[model samples]
Target: MDFFTAQEQARRQTGRLVVLLVLAVLALIAVTTLVVAVVLYMAGIGGAHSQPQPTLQGMMALLSWELLASVAVGVVALVGLGGLFKRRQLRRGGKAVAEALGGREINLNTRDSDERRILNVVEEMAIASGTPVPSVYVLEEEGINAFAAGYQPGDAVIGMTRGAIRQLSRDELQGVVAHEFSHILHGDMRLNIRLVSLLHGILLIGLAGGMLLRSLRFRRMGGNKRDNSAALVMGLGAALMLIGYAGTFFGNLMKSAVSRQREYLADAAAVQYTRNPQGIGGALVKIGANAKGSALAAPQTAEFSHLLFSQGIKQGFSRFMATHPPLKTRIQRVMPGWDGQFVALKPAPGVTVEPDQSPQSTAGAGGRASVRDNVRASLENAGAPHAGSMATVLSAASVQMAIGAMGQPDQRHVAQAQTVLSALPAALKTAAHEPYTARALIYAMLLSENDAQRQHQLAVLENIALPDVFTELHTLMADVARLDVQLRLPLIELTLPALTSLTIEQAQHFRLCMERLIHSDGHVSLFEWTLYQLLLSHLSEHHGGAENLTLQACERECQRLLSVLAAAGLEQGLESVQERASEMAHALHAAQQVLPFELAAVEDADDMQALSLAVERLRRLKPLQKSLLLQSMARCIEHDGRIRPAEAELFRAIADMLGCPVPPLLGGGTEEQAVLAE
Candidate 1:
């Protein structure tokens, strides 16, 4: 599955959801219209039927247009408002989902072995998958379930039940994490959120009806009973209760169909991702035998049942309403030719299943090796530019390879990720593991090299920095300053989860401090601006910058983005400016072959302001459009046959802004070598 194509498909699913929702609303309108007509007849607002009984046709004809219209309007408004209100509540994205489910985030510095192991699995998977590591949450429930939730990669969170953490082996845990990551990569999360919100809106009617019925019963018991008006109210409440449940029945059918298909896809993807069916297959077997049986006990589980890894509630008598496919069917899909028998696992106390032979550990093996060896090999493969070598451009193919690796790492990329992690300075790595030190570390990264500018940056930090933050800053500044430019962005990526642990007020203040530092020098360096914007964009709890953008509507912004990139290539090249301009024109022409795009003029070649605006607009582009844009930017930058660290940083910054987390280009291989490595 191509990442861009998968995202496009997800967008189409949202459209399908809209069509389905409209049908559901119409159904509600029809049901409510009939119910209201009956209510009126019972209330004697229509002519009293004292003398003659009306036929079924007469009853249909007696439905007043005025009353029907009122009920239709009322149902539409109620359903629409309920859905919109729920969606609004969820605008905070993955965090909201996690909180709603009572998930407690596991701190990166956690001491518990199981929690730490889960974190390791998640981090490695994140690195291998080329996405920023998501924040991890633990549901206190003992059910063996997990889920990935978020609208976009930046704010995504991973939630696992305590049962999953304790009961599964490392490989089994890996399989579960990989399965959740597939959901993230395949674009199911946003759709899942929409389904939950829409179903809630539909379910609200039934709840309201029940409330009305209960109130009527209470009234009857208290005083007013035998009168016609009281009888009418009782009849109306009972009718609404019935209609409300009818709506719920249909809504669950829709939810079940959608949820079940995605579960199969996720299971298959997990097997492909790990290249190990037994890992995930073993997890299923365990769930089958375990007493807990992956059934969640949380009050909110019913609402989020479709999002969990396994059936969170009873499947009920009807299979059509089950959120997940049966265990046997799912297992067969991952492991064909299996006999229809399940062996329930019962590991000895304090023991977990270990594979007969780990696929990643063998010499000459094409799959996973021992974690320590993988780490060591990756460190050995890490490369640096030769001193005084000024080649700063890469070939077109190299550019394509780099962008292609974004959010879709192969074995080679996974190896390089290990190297990137290994390459981190020990001090910096420590700081990234804690919120306060992580804040100090970022401040240190943004501190200017020049003495006067550095002092001014320090002044900005002094106002907001806790005493401990300043002490940590003083301790870590020199090492961060001496760090390689290629390592800077990765370090920032590493610290994101820890930084996310901050309270909203602290995060806001952190943003303020970052902005102050960037503007303190009276000139925003490209690196400074990029780092500040990227940090604020991801860290702000309420930032929804890309929510409204569409590729079809943002054509000019696309052109502006490519033009800025083309112009940057032109200015930064060692060749004559005109010659570089010609090279960029060729690159832009190549981009047109892949996407419907064109460059307007080279006059804006050095337009820094245009570049910033372009970044903002392009952030809203759909996943496929973003892929094309990233490829286009790479083509333009690599036109001169050299790619400077600064240009590479800018390229990565733009991709990250669009919610595509890119690892260090070719694992920090030198320009010519990295191109060859690609």
Candidate 2:
């Protein structure tokens, strides 16, 4: 259940994939060389004015080292280039994959009840897990399947079939979404995308051969010379076609080898996440009973077969080649000791299952002592440095709860997320779903409290923003100004899908206006910086593969990040500069004890620019290393035993940038109490 461990496993899986690709390529080259050698020997013997090479030694002579080497080179070049081409095409991330399969993004403002329900479910899960809300797409098919696709969490999107929204009840839909989210959390999407690209390379030879065969229809072959030439081309094309398909057959085996086990893991994860086995178990049963089942009619389904929730295409000839386990087996695994009966697909009202009253379910639904309160009380008891006392602010249980929530949020977190969503003002929530008002909502969030600064920001936006957007900002300013501070981050999370829907021109204009507004104040506050970084990171196109950096190599970046967290944690009303410096030293010391290396002295000029650069650099750290860094950060921020609202926000932002999702830490307190405690 450790997030970083899952990510490391995925990295290892990539290495295995590469080895398989290499083997497949070598096999293709060998087959292709043999085919070429036979063609050459036959042509030599059939020549009209040349001596015939009909002997075994003469045929061996045609299969020279040079000829074999040339074929090898040609095969390698074709496969390598084909894979690179496909990988580049998918560089736009999951959206490109979804769109290529004919998925239309569900509009955030859609009034359809099913679309709205799915969006709400997605938003709750995202907020609970501390990741950005992913855009949702619906394929125009009636198969009960879903997929989560992206290179990373920032660009991830969830795709569902039409049948899934219509056929599955609310709990069943939640289960399906949870399964896809598991793929997003465990790094399966990137691996799936790479598989697609590699398979395309293996199949390229077949594509070329088919094209060659089809071109013969336009050519005139009346002359003897032309006839021979046509025959040679036809033979070579046929050989390549056969060889390429054979390579693809092995590639499919590789896909099954890699993906089949992961599907089981995802199903188990879905059950664990929702604390209700019947949710996902029922979904599988429906898929088994339905006529369309999980099969897709799209022609590109073969390429993305391994990415779906179930077998996306019909398995022919060999069950071993299926990317998913059989339906009955998967259901039994999730729901053991049950009679094996497929749920009949009836056109009745949606079933409403009562909530489970088991102890585990009750605890997940907030029946036990709150972890957030425990951490807060511990911090409160530790006291500030200036108060002439301090104690251990993080208890074992509190630390476990905090770290355990990352990429593996339990039902409690989901329940709390639902609470947060319900608390939002209706108008503000509605505004967050449309591109125009979403932009305005963000603009309003950045408006300054001081009269002069607020006027300046407003003027800047008025001159630069689109007229309708500017007007919307004016209308939403009152509600945004009154928004609870604890809800700000969640609200920002909600805006991502809508913001991402903006046209290229509109997005460019929005970014420009935001920059102007932030700089118009002459300085960026912590909240402003966090908002800008979070939005830009998700909104920009993500390209390139992951970079591998050890903690040792990123020591300087690590130091800067820790230093910023330390500075952010200092209480504002310290009586003297010496007191402030003393608190900072104590925070650093706390972090140093947890980290493996010695802490470096941080300069007083730890501005937002320096912190931003440091975060960007540290993002490349290996997954486990990132886990350690996050722990050290938590230790540093908790040194004084209390977390201010701003400090908690900064910590969450840092974790999000590093690809870690920390559940909300300010839960279970009244809005006034939470604000006043800071």
Candidate 3:
């Protein structure tokens, strides 16, 4: 499915979920009212004093309208409260989900070869997909399962089972990660989270019922309570239990209905993305052949079964409760006409140690080389253009089309990613691998070519950063300073996952330090502002709040950002600024035919503050608006028919800020080399 369609589907699914939840709530309220009335009648609340007996008709008469209303209200509150609580608990995004499943975050600096290999595959995929590399975690389960979880691209995390890491080859692993990426790209994570939380809420009634029943078993009924009272309490407990299970039954039906088809789409997308059916299909075949069969051993797997690349938990009800399609059916979809037989696979022999391939190795079947062959794959991938297959000028009629092109994963991207990954500097690549070195590497990029500015920035760092980090900064300064204009942003992109590992306080301090350094020379270059904006926008989780603004609502912000683009493009001494501005205006006008407006003239600002504010506001724009914004930005930059280094950097920074990790323009290799040489 395309990006906008997927987004629309997610919205529709949410609506369906709400309707289902409401129906379930109503059903629960009705059942609870009946149970309450039955218990009360049995307890003799409706019996005559002389008769000492309650008939069914008498009980029906005793069930007041007020009682039913009260029960309905209570039921709604319980379900609503449970959902809200669970949502809050999961609000931390994919990391929380991973942690709940007993996943351990992979340290960037780990020497373990398998961990390093996993990081390589994830990095390549992120670069290929034009997204920030997500945090990766490893679950200790022996099942061959994996998942991607997050509310958005930035907070997303990729999780793998110990079994997945051990059993799947490099190619198979890529395919599985691609499958999870499909979920991430298609906006399935948020809906999945909602489903899990809402299902939990529905199950809360059952849990409460079970608790009451368990309590009744322990509480003695002999002291002061009449037989009917004890029996009524038991009946109430029994009724609650029944109602709770009923809620679960309905919730499972909804979950299955919502989840099963998406699994099929994701599987298809995975094969399409890698252009290698064997990768994902092989993984599935292994799952079937193995005893564990892609089943997660974690207790929490049942909650997020829909998010997994394969079924994470066993479904008791074949077609009704299964979050994913049957393994054989899924395998056949990817690899058609497969006999219903499992393949017996084994680990590669003598692959006990880390591969030692130089940074330049891009050769393998489908760019799937063993770990021993491509130690620098991660960095090289970062250096390459993200979407080299498409011409630098992305073609789109609307914002969604533009974003769809940006977000879609393709086989061409894999080749270009490998090419880019192979060309990175060894030292720069090494620095991006470890947490401490990664920070220093970024500082090195910020350090000026001017000796005075460089020293001033270093002094700010020394005062704010720890002594060790400062020392590392000094050590890596020479290598970082040697980096050319084109490679700088890619290096920063490489550092993002490690930077994300920083504490909130550390991130804040890092943000502050960066601001002081950028302004230290008494001026902010466009490149500096762009770089700072990209770093700070992503590094700070709540950078611009939500992207909830309609295109009409964010008109001013869009104009301001467009003005910045116009100014940046014109700054390169292009002959006619007006002509370029006219071209930009035309692009904006064409892209946003729905909201026709001319480009507002650039308003001067004393500092980069205007551009920063423009970006902050632009973050609030909806996806379609962002598409128009990107198209307009690209038009402004490409008016000269060539993307210069400064323009390319600005473009990348803008894309990253908008949560689109645009690959390096001009497709790396000789083109980038020529720019660096210039």
Candidate 4:
């Protein structure tokens, strides 16, 4: 869960993902080969049969031509289909990412207090781990299922069913969240999504041609009169359809193989993240014993079989299409004595929440809490001495415990959020649009890992919402955390409610994230952090936070990073990795927000001179970073707190030259910092 380990996990996950991509490409190639062979074989047979009066040599030659034509058409059709599916995936996935996060699903209007409580937990985990809080949504279905989805952490999302909300204990729920979070941090989510897109690309070929067969059937029956190229068209259509199908079977095999490994890793990571295999193990067992043991009936479930918490549908072999390992085997790994029966750990009526003693929670019935505390304490003691690294995440038990506990925090995070909500005095409703109330809520959501990170996030908070209210609320970080003056959420939440209003400035408020993290240890560990900040700020200023280019650019950037994190697969799933995931995801999400702008800026530049001028201008903008060129671009553009499409295009070109994937701008596609009043 330390910095280096997270990076290493990312590297490993990325490596595996790259391999999957290679295999997907190979699968497509194999399909193409098969389709061509099939079409050629069939065409040769048909041609040989048609020439009743021909000699053997003439028949052979005619058959060869027929086969060649069929193969040619088939190959083209297959490749075209491959490209089409890739585009479709990117487009669909891109749209899904946008709506999954900054969309209305996570908006204020949709969340009730209970749902908000869960969201509050997610936010706290992200802040603690330093990841972008994956957007969350609720499923009205009565099923007890949950899932994490996204091409990468930055674009990741978590959704829970109503059954999950009402049924599971807080700790058990934590176990579930931790498990899903594990998938996000270890890059399984990206791989899972890739599986979907790759499979789609492979199958679409056959599916496309299959549809065409119907059209060809009509032509064969003389339903049409056009004679030119009729044979050629028919041959082409048949070949393409045949080829498309040949690609599909191999693609499914590849998907199953890659998906299985990731699932095992995710299982281990879930144990590792929670530090209590029993939590996840127990959850799995409960699923089996409960009437609805991961049984999914939705038609769309098959498309996402590998992404579910448990097997939604019972597939043959119970292993091969079953996205997860058998529940019994998983349980044995974590709890040797587990009886395969659900242990009844019901809380007393009013004890829905854990008792407020974390130090004691460490030693309570649930073994996960104490182990997590020990790990955090160990890391904290390592302090400035032991720079957190991938190597630090060891101990079969501790890792598992850490992983499990990671899903749920010690309740303080939730309590704090609750306090923020409760503190809003009745009077605060009168000034519904005050800047400070929004700022206070933002801080409640934002509170970070270390002092420096919190402070840096605070700086980004500057001029964001009710600057004055935030100014007053900012003083509390010292009181609650640094000084431990009060432990109640009410005190923290009550900061400005009676006196001010809450409102959203825009999502671009995160432009300063890289700077905050870069300065985490009182200094930037990597110079890239500064440049990242500069890039976001400049882009946000020129393009509104809602700009498509900005959002696209950031997504692209996070995807590249996800490619990196793909290397990770800890014993824990999303548990403690929460901090690392959230921090990076948020940073990456910021970049995603500005991607569209970056892409246009890169592809549309007319010449090196224009690109250079734009780069130079961007360079001189406020907040210089180690990336000299990035700084230069900032300098070039911020002359008037604006960047026109012309300038945005120029910025895009420079980013390309620098070899950076454009991230979609955070928020929406609008230019950064709209002048809307509270």
The per-prediction CA RMSD against the true structure, in angstroms, equals 4.8, 6.3, 5.4, 16.1
Candidate 3 local lDDT, 1-678, one digit each (tens): 666457556766777789878887887888799888877766766552213665677667657799899898778887888898998888777888999999999986667777777877887787767677788999988888998988777778999988888888777888898888888877787788878889888788778777777787777778675556666667787887788888888788778777888888888888777767888888899999888878887888888888888878777856778888888899999989678899777853222323222122222343343432243244244544342112233222222322445646665565445554555566667678666788788777777888887877888778887677778887878766655565566567678888888888887777787777877888988778777777776665552355566767767766776656656655445568577666656545443444546666555633478767767777766666665667667765555455556666677678778755554443434433332222
- How well is each residue in 508-603 modelled by candidate 4, as lDDT tens digits? 343343334344445432113323432333232121111012223233332332222221211234567576455434333333332333321132
Q: After superposition, how far is residue 80 of candidate 2 from its true place, in Å?
A: 2.6
Clash pairs detected, candidate 3: 355-372, 356-372, 380-420, 380-421, 381-421, 386-663, 399-627
TM-score of each: 0.87, 0.89, 0.86, 0.53
List per-prediction Cα lDDT, in the order shown: 0.72, 0.78, 0.71, 0.43
Worst 10 residues of 4 by lDDT: 669-678
Off by over 4 Å in 2: 45-56, 225-227, 347-400, 666-678
- On TM-score, the leading prediction is 2
Give the candidates in order of lDDT, highest first.
2, 1, 3, 4
Task: State the lDDT of candidate 1 residue by residue for 1-678, as single tens digits.
Answer: 667777778778878987888898788878777876666665555773522564566456557778778877877777778888888888877878888889999978776767777776777677666576789999998778888888777778999998888888766877788788878877888789888888777777777777776776556453543356656667777776677778778888888888899888788777665556777877887788778889987888888888889998998889998989998888888878667676766541333212111123132223334543445344444353331112223344545676665545544554445455555676787688799899999999889888988997887788877889888999999888778666677678778899877888888878887878877867766677678777766776534444346666777776766666665555543478578657667767755555664665446544556666767777777777777667767766776566767677677777777766665565334442332232
If candidate 1 were superposed on the true structure by all CA atoms, what would the RMSD be?
4.8
**What's the lDDT for candidate 2?**
0.78
Q: Alpha carbon lDDT of residue 82, candidate 3?
A: 89
Best by lDDT: 2
Selected candidate, larger lDDT, 1 vs 4: 1
Which candidate model has the greater TM-score, 1 or 4?
Answer: 1
In model 2, pairs of residues that clash are: 379-641
